[model samples]
Target chain A: MSITVQGRQAATTAAPAPPGGRSRGPARVRWAAVAFVAPAWLYVAGFYLYPLASSIRMGFQDYTVSSFYTGVAPYVGWDNYSKVLHDGHFGETVLNTVLFTAGSLAFQFAIGLALAVFFSRRFPLGGPLRSLLLVPWLLPLVVSGTAWRWILDTDSGVLNHVLLNVHLIAHPVPWLASTHDSLTAVTLVNIWVGIPFNMVILYGGLQSIPGELYEAASLDGAGGWQRFRHITLPLLRPVTAVVLTLGLIYTVKVFDVIMILTQGGPAGSSQTLTTFAYNLSFQQLEFGRGAAVGNLLIGVAVVFAVVYLRATREQRQAGR
Target chain B: MSRLLRTSRLFRPAARPGALAALAAAGALTLAACGTGSGSGGSGGAPDTLTEIDYYDAAPQNTQLPQILDECGVRNGVKIKHQQVPRAQFMPKLLQQASARSLPDLALIDNPDLQQVAATGGLVSLSKAGLSTEGLYPSIAQAGQYQGQTYGIAPGVNGLALYYNTDFFTRAGLEPPTTWAELAADAKKLTQGPRYGVAFSAVGTEEGTFQFEPFFWTARGNLKELDSPQAVKALTLWKDLVGSGSASKSVVTWTQADVNDQFMAGNAAMMVNGPWQLPTLNADKKLHFGVVPIPVPSPDAKPVTPLGGEVWTVGHSKPAREAKAVAVVKCLLSQDESAKWSKDAGYIPSNQRAAAQLASADPQLAAFVQEVGTAKARTTELGTAYPKVSQALADAIQAVLAGGTSPGSALSQAQSAAKN
Candidate 1:
């Protein structure tokens, strides 16, 4: 945003002071701007726009393996969408995707906020401790996911071992091997992976609020909870909104973590829309239906963003 | 309209509607040009170096296969650039390359996937390239065919066998079991603290189905009749194994490699795996293992297993490059090389005579060699539809083993699922 302002200032200052400064100056500056932005524009067009357009177009065609080579895909209109929507596993998959995303976000945010509030107080080793919290975020998802897989293994896992020794349960839980627990197991891992991001963002938000508000509130007989309620929560709303919005987007399309841990398995109990789309496209070789599922996922993300934006807007208006 | 007029007047003084139309046409042409077409390379003239790709990213084969490719490249008078991708990513990578019309000059595709890749019309017919499947196992030869034309040919092949820890069997006063009843009884007896009696893959992938096929086929389960009684019985065997505490519940999550790791670590007394694990198992000098054909329902019943191997296919490219690729394939499939590859890579030779020689020379591989005689190709019955059916079957196994679904009902669901 600042770069754009700087660029505009430079362009204006240079526009009228050149040799052919009156008529051709603005056009030349505009052409120069276009030249500067061409690489980025071409990159967006080639990578993002082209693939998104292809995926959407593919959803309306009977694309298949042969279609890739022959470049011949007959139009099928709504057939792919209808077929995916009517699949026997579709309802279960949607439910799983919802539960996985909601469970991950709620816990991640709550725990992250608590930790951020705790870390707001200065103490010895606080800097190092806060930096250490970023380890999960720093590691590649695949590497951490694989490590989690071992830690969650049923009979041999350290988790079950510790749980058994602590007498938490009578039997070792089949974390990845049972259909009943696989979804919860994957969600727990995702929450663990996401908490670091939530914490770092919310922590930054917590730091930006003025200490004077808390000091004044305390001076006026406002207790800890009262001060936090009146000052902290209201002040952190915008940052909270950004954190949750990005969190929702990231969690909705999480593919690698679940893939590495479960592959949506133990009889598809953990299968989500992202993995389902992938399975349809690559595993089953039904590219059209896969693209349709992919489009539906995009619809889901868009719906979430719109509803969230509207709710936050209403909240801001009400705040005034 | 005003914005457009201002922009055009600022940019060009002589702009007109015709000129705008011409510019739009030029832009559309440029966009269309960006769309996929024949990919770069292998153009202008056929190069002397041919490209080859495979998923042999494991030890022994990973290191050994490149040497073989170099030898074949020398024999064919062309330099071969061999590339290997991980097993899971191999098919997706190949499909992507195919769509871009930039398939490698040669590809060693898994046997079951050959039909799917060939169906894309991205592979050169081996017959047209002057290659023959003569002397290869009939099942292997059939595996390479798509629409009655041979698109690939295998130098060597493999099939599942029961690898047992000899130390466990000896300590327990047990003999190698040849029938399902004895196998189950022995597995129960072998189960002890911190150890499973048996381990096999039941993961949600083709490897899971590949590991399950011996029991499935030995029970006379047909791929087209997935809900038949035979299929239910096969699934029930696996469920009973886990339920009886002879197999771990974790079998549903294990790949063949994981199962092998369990068996090598003494956590599993026996494993259902292929000959490709021999090198790794042998590397552990303390592990004393013996191989046998997967058990049958009765002593008289024959054990039928799926043939597992990779087949070399010449990819569609310039005529000269394809001819050179085919020559390399032919060299790789010659009788001497076939026997050598079978020995070095822990596979059974696809050629009957070469296999017979290998079996006698290496008594340890006799079980796999013998199984290959009766082994069937996964794609022979369903062709390109096999992968879908295989996935359905894998899901049924996981359902029965992990989801607690009855075998009959799970297979029934799988059958209906595969139909679409």
Candidate 2:
């Protein structure tokens, strides 16, 4: 399967030998390849790597609002990290971050995978219907979050209105107002924002898996559930890895949606690490602490990425 | 996946190791660029044009500032380019500009934050640039002075006042409250069915803290001693209102704008808000509202509201450009112009003479003018330390109002946060 071939390409011992006839042009082609990727590399170095290094450097310094102008921040070594770790809100924020990530990822993936499988079934206007599902993904998060805020407003929100009308509860739910429910409300909104992304990615992965494999499974007298369990799940592993890894990265760093909704508030109940870092840097004017939190967020992303790659590598070895 | 990848590819592809490296590099460069390239700078010359920036990104002021600035620009013989950023982004953007050594020759900063920015040694003291703070309200003048140096000067100033629904009050047959006991009793009596008797932001932001300042200071509470008995009394009044179901529990999350919305919708009988919301309130013709100074802890206690307005100051520049920038600022704040802006923009004038002339003529701003006379500069006592304390106070407000924490404990906790 090309999926396995694509997966195995990473584990190759050395660069694949050029076709025998191409030897005369290898040097020119090599230079041309370098030329093709050079702009991307330059863009990368100029934009991303430099600022990241600066942030990492700033993480060790006592950066502040004054530092923004003076360009001087005394090196504080691990002081910022230690201060952040010992912060009163740190434990709750970290626990909230974990809960937010896990809740958002689980639902986003499940709903996305389900929709991907559902849409993979041929139907009238299937293409248009699938395209239509991308609206939530297209709307700016600020716009969506604002709209949701109105809908979830405890006093006049339409969500509470509908629920009350239907006798769902005796009183309105304080979606953004109550600290107890604020995290759940934020997570739900995040999940809604993420499902479209998951659906689209998993749907593409479903498409890449050839139909003949399913047909072969059917010929072996496998039932619908049996075929899906045996063939679809196994073959879609590469795509699942792609969806999950990307989802983990995105979910762990969700900020704007939360910021627009709660601002890590009602006494910092809904704060995630991203908002905490932002609050420290921008709101508190403590850039060093913000940078430390930001570095820790990157550490989280790295751990997830490593796990994803390790699983991919194991699958590749199994294929071999 | 192809559909998603196709769109993702258009913007950013999924970050593999190489892509992650590229992503970081791209992000770093774009972020760095925000602080690089002297976005606005004045070199050593009699420049024909001077860049100016402010946070007047809302109506009346946003539309009014440019015309006023241009008139000043014309008088000073320099074309002024004004940039209005979102109010929230104003400080961060200014700091970025300052860091890049590209601060505009002319800038308008919120009065309370001027001290913090001035302390950075980025602002050119206006006194050094031939601008006078004379004829300004004492408290308003205090906002522009950091230590002994005057770094900013306002054309106009504003303060919080009570905006009560006339219809609601008339129906309840109650006069506007002048003391804390009356306020609490009237608030409880007026609150009925769907309407909250009073609304004020206790949101976890500067706006919340700004709204709380009137009550806090009126009770003779100081930011440095937030855990004092007087401060606790001030917070308890708000807690009682919410606890008695006289105000919405959601006030902890409401901005002044939100509070105004509630008042306009008849959901709130009264609100503590600034004159900046006056234009919007005036737009709703059916909303019969009356303005009064915020009620004090007692009839004899003085009401001390926080000063609200942006002060125009010159950024770091060579003498030639600084002279021109200062000239423009002067023209913007001249006696006639200050009065004109105060009238046109519905803000209280900083020029006390202009303010007095208007106070008798424009009854709508009379209460605010009275309040601005004694309005305290939030940073006057705490100086640059005010923002931190303001932040802590705002959080304490949230804890007390929303989290149901006791006022005493919350204030003490916030007081410690401020010290740290």
Best by DockQ: 1
lDDT string, candidate 2, A184-297, tens digits: 999999999999999998888889888998889888899999988988898888878878888898899999999999999888889999999998888777889999999999
State the lDDT of candidate 1 residue by residue for B1-420, as single tens digits: 234324444334344345444554555466444432322345656566888899987888998898898998887777888889888778888877776677888889999999999999999999877788888899999999998899999989999999999999999999988988888999999999889999999999999999899999999989998999998988888899999999999998998889999999999899899999998999999999999999999889999999999999988877767777788898999987887787888899899988988789887899999999999999978988999999999999998899999999999999998997
Summarize candidate 2's per-residue lDDT along B1-420 as a digit string, tens digits: 234323334232233456556566666466667654433344566778888888776678788888888888888788988888887778888888877666788888999888878877888988877778887888878889987889999989999999999999998899999998988898998988888889999889898999999999999999899999999999999989988988888887798878988999999998898887888889889999999989988788879999999899888867787788888888988887887787667788898878888889877788998888888899888888888899889889888877779999999989887887
Q: Can you tell me the CAPRI class of model 2? A: acceptable
Tens digits of per-residue lDDT, candidate 1, A58-144, equal 999999888877889999999999999988789999999999999999999999999999899999998899899889999998899
Q: Candidate 1 — which pairs collide?
A: none
Candidate 1 at residue B390, lDDT? Answer: 95
Query: What are the Cα lDDT values of the candidates?
Result: 0.87, 0.85
